[model samples]
Target: MRLGGRRKSTNIQDMRGSGSRNRGGFGRPTRRVRLPSGGRTMRSSGGGIGGIVLLVILFFVLRSCGIDPLQILAGGGAGSGFEQMLPQSQRQNPTPRATPRTDAQTEFVSRVLAETEDVWNGIFQANGRQYPEPVLVLFSSQVRSACGFASAASGPFYCPGDKKLYIDLNFFDELEQRFNAGGDFAQAYVIAHEVGHHIQNVIGVLPRFNQMRQRMSQAESNAMSIRVELQADCFAGIWGYYTEQKGLLSRGDLEEALNAATQIGDDTIQRRTQGYVVPESFNHGTSAQRREWFARGFESGKLEACDTFNNDV
Candidate 1:
């Protein structure tokens, strides 16, 4: 986490105060079409875990109203699943505001992103492929992404639809205070994990997963999601490996990242949220799995070592 003197990434969009004025409004203009060629929506299949849950609720609601679930999903209406499930009062299309002051936290995020860019670029080059850097969008409260509208409550996510990473800075506070996964390295791990998604997109892993998930059952898809998330966690560790090679990591930095991986495990979150565990609904992997994969990547620093798909993750 010794980030001093590290270069900051220029691929950043600051949209802190330029969010929506209404609960469901977009502060900025967004594309009404499907995601770009390389972009997919969210990570989970069937619109992601939240999306699936909402879809079920919505289906039941529509059915209760004597409406067809298929029609709503295919309604092409303003209140479609894509538009209705956002946090209330999320607005977009606000006037561009002045860039916020650069603080230590912001600088740290940028540096970490830059490091990922460097590490991934090298890795891709070694594989005879060029790396396309993804944009990182910093927002507050709520933001509209090519994937969908999301609030801080949604946590950090990568939008393949936009080839960008979306993060609400407040989530860092939540990670530290609520999740008790505080540390600069922990924060870096979060960013690197999303960047790992970008790597998956570049390598065509996400697209295939998205397609396969469409045909998968909820339990099956959630299992697939755990693999996807764990792979990203491993990728984050890969980045950590290179960072350590560069002598940028101090003692206990890796521990911070590992603790973060454990704290945010699906089991831990589920236990905290509902006071019970539901292994079937777990999208992200268990704490042990996450920690194990991360350690695997850091120890080996090999892409082949990070394959959570072909092997039991």
Candidate 2:
């Protein structure tokens, strides 16, 4: 990705090297050096389904908590997608411990965020609606938000309650080393996938899903989640569509994002870890499904193409 001279997003809340104890019991970063979540990295993928356009947005909503999502893809096994809504109180507003010094990687993430803002803001404005930008929280070992406590091991996740995406930059290192899915675009995909969840929240998809999921059985929720995550994947692709048009993408950028998506698919992770696949446990969809939805959004650049609920996925 050619992010040179791009504007960095001021919406970021830098909290690296900051740690605080929480009732969740996950305060210390050293004690819980997450496996590698860059690549649960609860990313999403796929096409089809109908109804709420925003319904396509929640597919990338919550990831499994503190489960090095990438390590699972690298062969840890028994994993879920990147939409984790930790059962923390949304009222908590813990103060920042400190703001660690920024670096090149931080600047990169901020620039990518700026790109998404430019894209989504224009999209929403075109439709006569204002796009509410979500705050991307840059935390280290642990941080607190309306969504509760998290560790870098939790990977990158969007909290609908708080409308903020949380990430530990170290997850990128894991993406490159553990999973071998490296590149700036791959990182952008992770951020965009989480932002997709925020899109769901803004458009009312996430609120509905969060309410409905409570009444659903575990299996039913998992099934519904596949659609949700895939839609988010499509949303990320939609963002990619605009990003590409802006001439920021290099030749291998799309593949880098797709490779990251494939590495985190439920089947790919399961096949590598357990030496078998359990279709029932699948929540994020297959590798092909993810790649397809992302491509669907990228190739078509239309929200209608991401309806994973009404059409065949």
Identify the leading candidate in terms of lDDT: 2
Give one digit per residue, the lDDT tens place, for model 1 in 1-313.
7888876776777677644332122133342222232321111111222322343343334323432111100111111011122223432322333335335566778889878877776665444455788887788767787666666556677877777887766667767876789898988988988887787666655654555445556676566567777778887888888788878998899999999888878777667666778788666778899899888878877766665655677
Q: Measured by C-alpha RMSD in angstroms, how accurate is candidate 2?
A: 11.5
Each prediction's Cα RMSD?
11.8, 11.5
lDDT score of model 2? 0.65
Model 1 lDDT-worst window of ten: 71-80
Candidate 2 per-residue lDDT, tens place, 1-313, comes to 9989886676777666533332122222221222222321111222222323444343334332211111111011111253222112211223333224236777788889978877777566445466777777778767676666665565677776667777777777766765567988988998988787777677666665665565556676677677777878988999998788767899999999999888878787666566788888777788899899988888876777777775677
By TM-score, how accurate is candidate 1?
0.74
Q: What TM-score does each of the candidates earn?
A: 0.74, 0.76
- What's the number of clashes in each of the models? 16, 22
Q: In candidate 2, which residue ranges exceed 4 Å CA deviation?
A: 19-102
